[model samples]
Target: MEFKNAKEARQKIREGMWTKPTPGLAYGYTQANLVVLPYKYALDFFIFCQRNTKPCPILDVCEPGKYTPIVTAPTGDIRSDIPKYRIYKNGNLVEEVTDIKKYWSEDLVSFLLGCSFTFEKALEDANIPIRHIEENKNVPMYITNIECKPAGMFNGPMVVSMRPMPKDLVQKAIDVTSRFPQVHGAPIHYGDPKKIGIEDINKPDFGDSVTIKEGEVPVFWACGVTPQAAIMRVKPDFVITHSPGHMFITDIKENDLALF
Candidate 1:
């Protein structure tokens, strides 16, 4: 069944009909990265996102003990709206679950972070190719030497998602993406991966690496998955986040969140 909007998509996911990545699900709506942490780490994590807005742009934050995001989707349930989730214990990924109802807690605070999928439709409308979508795989991502500013207990290297494109279209890609600053606007770096400390362009730290066609360059953008890196480094007692490529569908439209 084709969903008419983000709300419908979330309903299907919540109903267990969808348990996969949410790249192109709600075509014209904004998608988000899910991050749930104990209240003890809430203030610090909030600061971490504020300090590193490019990769961790805040879409909406649910108050402690609240499971629904009043700002993004008042009717949506964070614990089940996403297709899949990753549970981290003491910084180690312990399991991947479809529903998080069994892990809910009053001390847990949920953060909805802006995701790049929100700008993908713009790219497609602009005729820019999305290699990962074309290949039906997750976008290639890497941990760069670039360091994000630390906030309280959270700190780690910046992680970036890469897309390959013709040299001439690089500028167009940038212009289209720049319109959505709330969703990690624009490519942070393009061309040489090694310069960014990516030892191998073929081996991504997360997601699957796609082909860089002849005469095409790899363009890197700040990725929402970056928080996972911080989580691993900090090893908080408990954390729940959308598995890479799995996102939370929201009711907000793409243009509603566009800066543009």
Candidate 2:
């Protein structure tokens, strides 16, 4: 769990020394959602993310065939930086691999999208409890009734990640996260799971469901997984994305990403 910097952490991933969720790894740096698509679909997906900034805040995009994410992590290789990747063929998950070098090609474009983990430190500093981290589990995420605006062939329901916190700290969590718009900022919905089309809060579509205590309310934030949901519906020929909680750690510091 200890790394000198984002690059070093990524090196560990590249070497296959680390193959797990990257929440507590590379502390103080930003973690990003990875999306790799064919050159033909790049423009549409880019526009799709632009249209739905709440769930798909874009941080950087790599040109076709390029693996180096110059804007987010200049020296990092997108092919192996993330601990795990989900390979989708015609919208169905076909493989989950640690290294994607075999799938690398000149027709692929990589995107690094902002993640909510950028604001975890701020919330902890404010004394707000993050139940998932406390329990050493992945943040719970759900596919919702909220639909994303269509951009070309990409369109699907907006996905959200939930965090259970005490009622008293909800406002503080909102305030802390709102300062970082580059990350998914603020809670989109809170209190009721059925309101968002989540039939059972105890069971989540993605990631592990954590305990919701007596005084706690489940706060939902727009998730980076929205893009993956879109791909699932669109049925693209080939797509690469980080597994739900396995993100690509970036060189950018969290403080540099905050708005105020």
Candidate 1 residue-wise lDDT, 93-181, digit = tens:
99999989999989899999999989999999999999998998888889999999999999999999999999999999999999999
Best by lDDT: 1
Error of 1 at 121 (Å): 0.3
Model 2 bad stretches (over 4 Å): none
Error of 1 at 88 (Å): 0.4
**What lDDT is obtained when candidate 1 is compared to the true structure?**
0.93
What C-alpha lDDT do the candidate models reach, one value each?
Answer: 0.93, 0.92
* Model 2's TM-score against the true structure: 0.98
Error of 1 at 75 (Å): 1.3
lDDT of 2 by residue, 146-204 (tens): 99999999999999999998888889998999988888999899998999999999999
lDDT of 1 at 125: 96
Q: Against the true structure, candidate 2 has what lDDT?
A: 0.92
TM-score of every prediction relative to native: 0.98, 0.98
- Where does model 1 exceed 4 Å of error? none
Residue pairs with backbone overlap in model 1: 91-235
